[model samples]
Target: MNERMIRLADQSGRCDLHTHTQASDGMQPPAENVRLAREKGLAALAITDHDTVAGIAEALEAGKQYGITVVPGVEISTRAGGKDIHVLGYYVDPQHGLFLSRLAELRATRAQRNEAIILKLRNLGIDITLEKVVAGIGRELKPDESIGRPHIADELVRLGAAADMRDAFDKYLADGAAAFVLPPRITPEEACQWIIGAGGAPVLAHPGLYGDDELVRGIVERSAFRGIEVYHSDHGPAEEARYLAMAAEYGLVVTGGSDFHGARQGVIFHGDIGSVTVSVDVLGQLKS
Candidate 1:
């Protein structure tokens, strides 16, 4: 963070514990995210990109240059009870061999899902393809980089099939939508195992988005979770209150974040960086 920006930040040193980068589906490069976090006067920001840690190295370097603490993190996509569950892992060893291998497998599954979505779109006369979406990305995806529904949504917007990413999800890519695909994947329990296996702190990310408190509670109550995202850009006061009480009930670390994924077609995915945050003291609890 810039000196003035950092100085202007909340006196308590606020941290946004969730975010994405181009290494995943986010539009910004890892360095750019750090720079923005600095400009926004955040004490720290986590690079919790989906299924990969490719962004962490760059973010860490940027963190050093900008004097910001960049938490190495990943958001693992899992399935349970017919729902998509996301588990956020913090302070992971980005170069862990088994972790990398497992993430590669998940990326392959994601690629397959992307292909299936493309096929479904084609069948519906949408005329979009995986090749086109990759080409539209303007650069080749690295081994650890990922492509998800957001990329497909961008292509749909380009093809005029949808006005924006939100519309694309509403009409086709979201769960239960026309092109939605729910392949059998690991459960949240397994995801917790994966995170803990990598010596990272696993946090249940944005529980309110799941819509089923029972399923959310199941993971929180049963998994080896270190924290709960009690504060999120998408969460209302009631949702925040519910999760805060749950965190207290379970003795879990209380965390918060903006879940920033950068702007897509002039719309920010979840939130802007620093829009929702918690005191940086939680970083210590997470590390412990």
Candidate 2:
């Protein structure tokens, strides 16, 4: 552990267990995310980019330079009850062969979905292509980066088909829209198992936002999750209280984060980095 990080943690009790970077749909790069967390006085941060661990090495390297603890993490997309579920894995081995193979399969499926969405948009007389979307984003999709609806929405905005990301989604890219395409995903149980196999702790991400308490309960009962994200930028006091009670009842670790994706999508909630404060105890629990 870095001594400076220890001092910062003692002073602020700041630990953000969730965040994103350009390894996926986030606007900033992994190093920039680390720098931002350091500037904001965060003692620890996790780069839980969607479906990819490509950013972890960079984040860990940056963390060493910044004297902040960077937890290697990934947020996986899973399917449950016809709704999307996200499972966060912490302290994962990015180079684990099984995890890498599974992620590659998911990314391939994501590419297929992106192409299908583009075809659907074209069929609707809205001309767009995967290349255009990549170009609009100003970066080629990295090998491990999973193309998502946000990239499609950005292309739509560039093409003048929609005013902005929300407009693009409302017009043709969101679920039930003309250009919508469901990508392949593992189940919640499989996601938890994968994380365990990769030597990580699996946590339920943003259960309050799912709006299905029974479903959340069912996952907790059926899966091997070790933690619950009790504090998030989107969770209100009531929601946080309820999750806290649930965590205690289940003897699960409690985690929190800002889920910051940068300024492109605007303010997510409380503010940005340092928005949702987490206890360093949570990090210790996750590591153990």
Candidate 3:
């Protein structure tokens, strides 16, 4: 964690804008994820599942039951300058036509890609079976849901093919790694436009992960992004400062979160909403 983030977490702020649930790739189910969020004492959260809002409804219901605020969301993967960029769309309309269609297409592509990955793993003598991976989706994941590498990684661990999620990815699943699968998707601008059409705030997620400063700035300048995710597990102090400065220059909202998934995932939240130290006022700015 960034030192400044540690200081911010100490300040007792409000809201964790990014989160995940089993509706996408998270280990926990929506209800369980919400319960953990409540336990963490977050004032607000967004279940930004990858390419689908399937988890949001359940998360929203769970949040309501637990007296926590749920901000409907999805994390879309898109290409910007030939590099993959993920944009988090928050407070989205779940029923948006284009959004749903695009997600459906992406999910279909994911299934095919997963099959290819499984075949590649098999060829590599990894002992990974597609049936095992499919079975690892858990009961809460939908039939039409996009299966992520995390599920595959978990299956690998379960089947003794790999030690843990990180090992599985490092050995096979990471981009450009052996058995890596690519999804056919739209550009980052299209993703931003899709989110805007869904009446949501489109924010670039983890700019530090892009590894290209010029590409990062170009994406921000070209897209209708409402915010930049400065607070993330991958960002260091220098990267956070750079992103926060960029956000300010672009007149965008600055949001942060624990990016919490569950226990199996390495990092855990130290402070509830206070972890990022972003003011509760950021939510108001998002609405505007």
Candidate 4:
């Protein structure tokens, strides 16, 4: 009966639990993401920017102005099985010193990866420099913000080194690409511990993307994750069904989101703000 009531209430509103903003690699500012959610009629949004909570303050302020709830979140990058993995933390205390310190450490790894990619591009005669990459961004990145591959990709295209972001990634930045690098980093278990320590709920993000159910299963089994992203822009019906079952088997809550990063030259990254969402009631579940 309780679950049925929750479902009935969810029909009235929804939340997008995954998104990015310029505080990380996204093109839009934090407040703009909130405004977009308002326009989309979403009851809530989460600013799960990469490795930084710097965007959360502005997003939280916008939530009040725009009449939407912003979930304080971060997408921590991790590595396992020779692949990149991301863990999303919701309701984390943005001011937690240890969490900030740990995120800074992760950002440092990202810097190393970026420099390695730049070196590889230079070796390939692309001639893009880290300084040039920062210059092309039109503004100085925040102290907590580090250069991401997408920014590098944009600089490459701006320099006519690549046709587009996709081209830039396919040839240089994506996994298995010539310039790709996966430096050593914390495990997903450690990330989960970070989130838990910061009084946040950790959720496994985009399980299907891993291409290794065993890895996903191991993380779910080993970590203190409270939820799984059963619905995502990249997930198909089959993938969703599989993860939905996985969530049920693990007694985990299901969260879904568009993973919005705004459009670039008429191309939206994963999807638009409301392209995929879950019942707004799920927000309460995450908080609990």
Q: Give each model a TM-score.
A: 0.95, 0.92, 0.90, 0.95
Question: Residue-wise lDDT of candidate 2 within 1-288, one digit each (tens)?
Answer: 542234335436578888888898788889998998899888889999988999999999999999888999999989898778999999999999999999888878878888899999999998898888888778776778877778788778778899877788898987788788888779999999999999999999999989998999998999999999888878887888889899999999988887877765463422377677677778889879
RMSD of each: 3.4, 4.1, 2.8, 3.0
**Alpha carbon lDDT of each predicted model:** 0.89, 0.85, 0.77, 0.88
Ranking by lDDT: 1, 4, 2, 3
Clashes of 1: 1
Candidate closest to the true structure, highest TM-score: 1
Sort all candidates by TM-score, best to worst: 1, 4, 2, 3
Task: Output the worst ten-in-a-row residue range by lDDT, candidate 3.
Answer: 267-276
Clashing residue pairs in candidate 1 are 1-38
lDDT of 4: 0.88
Error of 4 at 188 (Å): 0.4
lDDT of 2 at 9: 52
- Model 3, 1-288: lDDT tens digits are 754645455433366777777777776777776776677666667788888898887888998898877788889888776677889998889988877988888888778889999999899887887777777664645764667888888887887877877888898898778888776778888888889899999999888888998999988888899999888766777898898899889998887766665555463422233345355677878878
lDDT of model 4 at position 144: 78
The reply for model 1, stretches above 4 Å from the true place, is 1-12
Write candidate 4's Cα lDDT for 60-99 as tens digits. 9999999999999999988877778899999999999999
Q: Compose the digit string of candidate 1's lDDT tens values, residues 1-288.
A: 732244235634888899999999998999999999899888799999999999999999999999899999999999876789999999999989999999999999999999999999999999898889998888998878988889999999999999988899999999899999987688788888888889899999999999999988887877899999988889887898899899999999988888899998888979898888888889999999
